[model samples]
Target chain A: MNSFTPDRTSFEARLHKIGDERYHDKHPFHHLLHSGGCTPDQVRAWVINRYYYQSRIPMKDAAFLSRVTDPALRRSWRRRIEDHDGTEDGTGGIHRWLRLAEGVGLDPDYVSSARGVLPATRFAVDAYVRFVRDEPMLPAVASSLTELFAPKIHKDRIAGLLEHYEFANSDTISYFQHRLSEAPKDVAFGLEWVLDHAVTKADQDAAANALIFKTEVLWAQLDALYSAYVSPARIPPGAWQPGEGLLQ
Target chain B: MNSFTPDRTSFEARLHKIGDERYHDKHPFHHLLHSGGCTPDQVRAWVINRYYYQSRIPMKDAAFLSRVTDPALRRSWRRRIEDHDGTEDGTGGIHRWLRLAEGVGLDPDYVSSARGVLPATRFAVDAYVRFVRDEPMLPAVASSLTELFAPKIHKDRIAGLLEHYEFANSDTISYFQHRLSEAPKDVAFGLEWVLDHAVTKADQDAAANALIFKTEVLWAQLDALYSAYVSPARIPPGAWQPGEGLLQ
Candidate 1:
């Protein structure tokens, strides 16, 4: 309620700042993960749980796209859908995430159904869709700005995951590799859309708020992981227990 | 899956042990919370966020209740609805929770509408409701095991919050006071219902799973708080932010 406003800073800058401060790029696990500091079980848990997030991104964008009327806007956002769902079948970002899952020794089917996803992960992703459905369109678009920092973390993750984890294969990392190119394009277009529309101070604030929402969505996912796999006791029912099988 | 079937004695004991271990009873915040170790600001945040959880409990039970045709069961479950919504205006658990909110300096109007609650709190609770609505009657009843633990915590919370916090009053602690008496009765009934009905190993496992689900629901709510308020970097949009007014 601090009506303090920033004047015409491209709106994107505010969104980017939100990411600079809040994005999972700075999450502890990411460093431990990228630097090969996490346990193998931890690495698999990240890939498996994150597969739920990765699979949802396209659906989230699709939901966002379905709300827009302009063919142009719809077309621009549709790339996000393509990037995840892929052209036909076992291909898109989801497929690549599946590869990550497989490389990390998870079942693609289990990841896709999201049967074993962390509860916090499920709620956070669902929260994004609800935010779009509940709030204004501009903020909804602004929330995607987490993509603003996705490329870097995704790159760090791909390299770190590959270098640190022996079970992982490059084919399974297809999703991260694809994201290196796709996220920038998506973030650029989404940024342009948000910047073009968020004219007033409220708009900038809204954009800033949206990125905060996206950041929470990612952060909560990690909190669930840390609590469940690392510093934790219960992983909740139906969540993947790292020590559940001979695979571990 | 761990197919090692346990007897009713071992199963119930092991399940309760999980409660002792994995339950939010073990969460530091909850301990700080019920033990009155939290700041007044922290207490206000707790009540404001928690009112959302308490307010929805009855509605979720109602939703599940509607799906059940057993009149005896309906008669039993109906008590929860009455416990929350109450017999008349400003009666029941919610009104009392408003007192708790008021005790902590939050507006009653805001508390009831959940205007300042964290998005993570909302989603975690909503997921619990969805779980009940989607699951069978047994699990629905089983999810209420958190209530069994609540009465003890409620006592500690009411006494500790009133005794320790500067802002609380006897009237404000009325919510937990009532819950202290009401929860044990309700939880006892729920435990008996589940224990008697879950005759098979799968049924017992599921009942255990349901309790685990409830534990996660509560735990995830706190995780959301720890990430958002405790960590601050992950605070989502449309959630209560400190040093700012409680509106989005």
Candidate 2:
């Protein structure tokens, strides 16, 4: 290897370092949500905006799958779509997220409809879908490496929510429960694929940058939530106002 | 007409009302920018991020035109691409924007490369491109109606920049100056098209929402800029840092 190209172990460390420094787990909003510091309105805003992200997961996976040419890759990737969308409509990660929304007192239908998602959340999530759709396979696959960071967040969220919120339950927190299992399996494959493919220095750089971009995607969503509904609390025009999309 | 469907005059009034209420003109970032309250770093940040918006204009127009089956519409839309892209490189509104970048002591090439744009700016602008590329023709066309409110902002920008910033000059301010004439012509056609086509109340509502969506897109970018570089000033990872892209 050239002086510039790090060995595989080092490259792996770099990706993990990015997560350690930059993952949405580090975002203040997550700290608030996990610790139960969020008010009911704040929690509701989180559910509403987060549903936009959840709703797009399958779509993002589908966009990724649409671009994969290899049968093995397609078969493996197809599981992601199925996981979010489920074999039937009432199942899957998205439905679990809706259950959480309902548990938090939102109308599941309204949350599913995504009528009140913050524009920043939509923009951030849509950028992700497009990134997966349009970027080359390496970076696209590398972007999913953020999943490497997901399991810890899921654990924190489940434990924190259960301890603090009356709304938390096996049903309401099941989405994160499921992700605690699902993400590691998915990340194992994605990390292997990225690590195996990113042999050259330039390849490693692209992969690293893609992972950084994904973290921003995650971080920006929380930033939007925090900016709009937290500290300064300047909710932009057309976003969900408090009490607007509650269960009727 | 049914009671639900607004008359053309009122529909136009409704669009103007959305602009008055939600357009980026009212964004504090703009107020800071136009009134010369921004520091040199803020100006540079705006220049870098706004260039991403400018760079995408032609590609957005091309995406719009690729979907246009009608020859007259294609013919009309072609001007937008031409206006920004020019017949050759380094000649059009984009080039003029680069002049502004240089005037602000930034590297024109760096601005053109779009390496330093904020993630929020990219997400918001890319969402606009995708909206135009994918939405039904009405909302897609309606989204561009933000241009209807453009001339006044352009005029304010020109007058404000010239009066306040040392970097402001004829060459640097020409982009806004050019848009002074160009935007009116574009908006006249777009407004007429939306008014003529939105016959049903649902259609009017869709167009109005699309216009509102466009305003949000514009406002979100500034919100991002403000959030990152203004109030909380928490510059998201991978966005332009203040001193990195300066001209030598």
Candidate 3:
């Protein structure tokens, strides 16, 4: 095992490599979804399933916040919960996701209930939360580095969805639009924190692996979606069946 | 909202009801597996998937221990990690779980590596760890109340496997056997602690729900298994496929 830790730029490159190679944006389902390839049913399925991930983000952040002792860290992390959960009225990333659900012709209530989400989706998202909660401080912080790769995906998604699907609009896609601004700040802070703390080679390797793990958490969710909804569909029992929860 | 906390007997009954209503032992997959209805491949799948949960027990306990400030609580909780991780090599629940993996004709290394386990299993098990690590002390402690229900399942599992599967032996089944003795002490303490601390109605409800959430974690894993391995199988992409990871 290499015992030498790379300098900051090299370390940052290694982190980017993980995202470039492993981030879920590269998943085939995203390719299909973004490029006008998915049917309305498939889009609905994605919206319903992806909602599970969106809803859990704040909870995951809250779990992280609960463990943090540093007042400044807690204060910084607290904004994440607010961003997703909203300040007063229901108006955050989660609410925006629900709007996307509605725009996709799904019932907002049904989407929010999350009862119809794929079991695999639930598992993958929950795994992300657990990783944040239980891993050592460095790796836990590193896992959030997936945000480093998020802005581009959000940009691509906003562009591709608007260009491809009729449901794509400023109001409906506001979640991604908002995230474009929100994610970079989070990622910048997170990436710096990880780089600063991961002084040892072992710690660096762990942080890299944690980023990879986060990517898997994301990639796995898409894999589940593709397997169940794409060709030769084998939607797992009790997962949202296409045409089941469409908006009236 | 009910402002009155139920008396201890009522609270205890409520906890049992959550188990009775939601435990994985009641899941159809368990009925099949316990009754020898599963094929060998199905059994192998169970072993590989369930191992993820078994291996994480110590890590979960350690996360709990790290958060714990009380020496007495830490002293009591530390035993759980030891029980699973062992004080020395060639011991602990994780090692025994691998032995069972071996008993069922799987490569212990593959099992330990956990590369082939279902993503769903990883998620559910990780969620349990996160719940323990991050939730408020009362609810976090209450989640372990599922242990109160574990002994019976262990009893059932041991008898059923012995009666049904040729792999079943005194040695292979010893993990569950050991848990039978170990869990009761843990649960008795956990249940009492929960009862003692859950003084408010809201606390009692959160505690009850935490236990219920845990039962879902256990139940969801079996659901993923049954969905993937049972009828009209839709194994999430990259989960263990039977005949792939077995001992040669």
Model 2 Cα lDDT, one tens digit per residue, B1-248: 68888799999999999999999999999999999999999999999998888877766665665455333465566567557756454567888998999999999878877887889999999898888778998898899999988989999999899999999999999999999989888888888899989999999999999999989889988999999998899999888888888999
Predictions: Cα RMSD each: 18.9, 18.4, 19.1
| Candidates sorted by TM-score, best first | 3, 2, 1
Q: How close is chain B to the truth by TM-score, in each candidate?
A: 0.91, 0.97, 0.97
Best by TM-score: 3
Clashing pairs in 2: none
How far in Å is the alpha carbon of B207 misplaced in model 1? 35
lDDT of 1 by residue, B130-234 (tens): 787678878888888877677667667767777777766778777777877788889889888887777778888798898998899899888887776665546
Residue lDDT tens for model 3, A70-167: 33465566567657766444577888888899999999888878888899998898888888877898988999988988988988899999999999
Whole-model lDDT per candidate? 0.73, 0.85, 0.83
Q: List the candidates' TM-scores in order.
A: 0.49, 0.52, 0.54
Native interface contacts kept by each candidate, as a fraction = 0.00, 0.00, 0.00
Fraction of native contacts in model 3? 0.00
| Candidate 3 ranges with C-alpha deviation above 4 Å | A1-3, B1-248
Write one digit per residue (lDDT tens) for candidate 2, span A1-248.
68889999999999999999999998999999999899999999999999888777766665665454332365566567657766554777888998999999999888877888999999999899889878999999999999998888888998899999999999998999999888998999999999899989999999999999999999999999999999799999999999897898
Compute the lDDT of residue B165 as modeled in candidate 2: 95
